[model samples]
Target: MKTRRVFLQRAGISAVALAMPTLNPLLAMTKSADPLKNYAQTLRVAIMGLGSYGTRVAEAIQSCTRTKLVGVISGTPSKVVEWREKYGIPEKNCYNYENFDAIKDNPDIDAVYVITPNALHKDQVIRVAKAGKHAICEKPMAVNAADGQAMVDACKEAGVHLLIGYRMHFEPNTLEVVRMRKEGELGEIRFFQGLSGFVIGDPTQWRLDPELSGGGAMMDIGIYSINGARYMVGEEPIWVTAQEVKTDPVKFKEGVDETITFQLGFPSGAVASCLSTYNMNYLDRFYLNGSKGWAEMQPSTGYGPIKGTTHKGPLTEPIVTHQTVQMDEMAAIIFDGKEAEVPVNGAEGVKDMKIIDAIFKAIKTGGKVDLTFG
Candidate 1:
């Protein structure tokens, strides 16, 4: 399959060729003189779900330089009204799930950000693609690798972009660490330890439901460790071995994992030891070790102000809102055709899903599971 950047480049060439013959000399000259003028235009975005994370994302987008929250899609009528009034969304832009397909006719919306439950991502992303809009789906992207690939295919077929909401990919502290590792500051990377978890409050929440969440702590918080391992090591894992433990069987039922410790083996003989749990609090941290030096971050994946230190000194990157920077950078990706420093596309999401699939398989069989992204 052609990559998104290749597809965009090809499309851009064809578009330029098709428009050149019809362009008036004066208009062409004007366009050439200020090519960046139109590039600075705002990207109008519509948000789906309107849940807690969705609300946070909407608020964050308000701080974006080249993005606007112009529309909304929600199941509840009251939320639609509340969002419309608060965000200054028009009535025409507000839509229910059943009627959101009509967004194909609404030119005001450039993209739809799917911030709904994990299980709903596949269908909602495909629907967004079919509506002639770009898609920005929240992580974990989908319930499984197959679903994630389906969303990618749907967006590709529609000639639109599909971005996964990996906000940390745009985070300053995280990126600085990644940059250092890539610059060989970490030497030949050998090991990584990622501990990501949070205590669950409500047993009756949808996240506890296997059908809605796909899994338990692994699916929600554990994925951060999985993704961080991949990016921090800068390589695809060849195999995974995992073990699951549940202390509270009453709260975490069958198919819903409470705590999981997974290990990934890379082709370069590097290994990652990670833990994902729902019963633990303040477990967010990432540690990377290499032949020469090391880097560590505590409260790494938290909402804001991620702090870290390297073998040399402190990692002092400017702190910014993760979602806000993400939206601004996404505007560049969607409109200006800019490439992300760390990929956050559907393909990236699919790779993570593939790893997650392997981890689950490893846990189920109590053996090492070989991973193949293709």
Candidate 2:
């Protein structure tokens, strides 16, 4: 009866809509005026890193209607000057890493987007939380689960929102696939595969430094696969097993991983086989198979134009700028109480960190590591 009533109501609405062609002009005028309410609440953001990814995000933010880049936090003074000039940022809105705590007094800046190295996320995000502003940190939120939890606790205690930059969570093609899985367009999930990697050229960069990076390929490129597995399978992994392989000790060095192949077993008997590597190229892909249907993606987690196909046919979702959509959606989440389809909050980052911790332990022990997530 509930379904019948809903269907009848939809039919009535369709008939009214067809009959009310003249009403659309009035509706459009009303809709035009309604946008001013949302526009008035645009979020002012400060990005904390001046590196390549930070630059990408700053450029992407120019297109975001709901989120604006108004300030910057960088250790390099020269980059700060250049960015301020380029982005029309005022001197008062800028601060170096050592002095960013002063941002707490600046009411114009509402949030800080931390795009620094993996090891730096914990301290930086905690600081942002303590300043009584929201934090948006990049992936691999911390070096380990303990630090990730500490960031989560700090934000909770300070009463601020802590969001991880899981930009794919807002991507259209990715969301459509998740929607299909939830709507049973795909039946019970059986298996998933994620391959995320790239060849590293600069051996001297911060990404290769254990102190800054926390780990090698797994922390950098491998995280996408670990994150992708859970979202695609729609289940937290119960256990993980991993094996590591290193060819060049000179470049990779101690405490840094070169490549890892990990498996995640879910509670529903679903399993994931994934690979994370630094020496491999053209490895960005995700595949999911279920009892009734399958979806496959190549170049799955890249910056833009994430293409995919399902058992039905090609995924036809509109291609969108990932970072632009992400920031705008994040603005809604931080201010307007919007809930994402998959969580992009600090707890979600902690869950990924827990899996990474288990993966590293599994590599060292040559045994399976069990996981428990609430």
TM-score of 2: 0.90
Local distance difference test, per candidate?
Answer: 0.87, 0.87
The sequence of per-residue lDDT tens digits that candidate 2 reaches over residues 138-230 is 998999999999999998787778999999988788988999999988899999999999999999999999999999999988999999999
Model 2 has an lDDT value of 0.87
The sequence of per-residue lDDT tens digits that candidate 1 reaches over residues 76-120 is 999998998898999999999899999999989989999888999
Worst 10 residues of 2 by lDDT: 20-29
The reply for model 2, stretches above 4 Å from the true place, is: 1-38
Error of 2 at 193 (Å): 0.3
The runs of at least 3 residues in candidate 1 whose Cα sits more than 4 Å from the true structure, single-residue gaps closed, are: 1-39
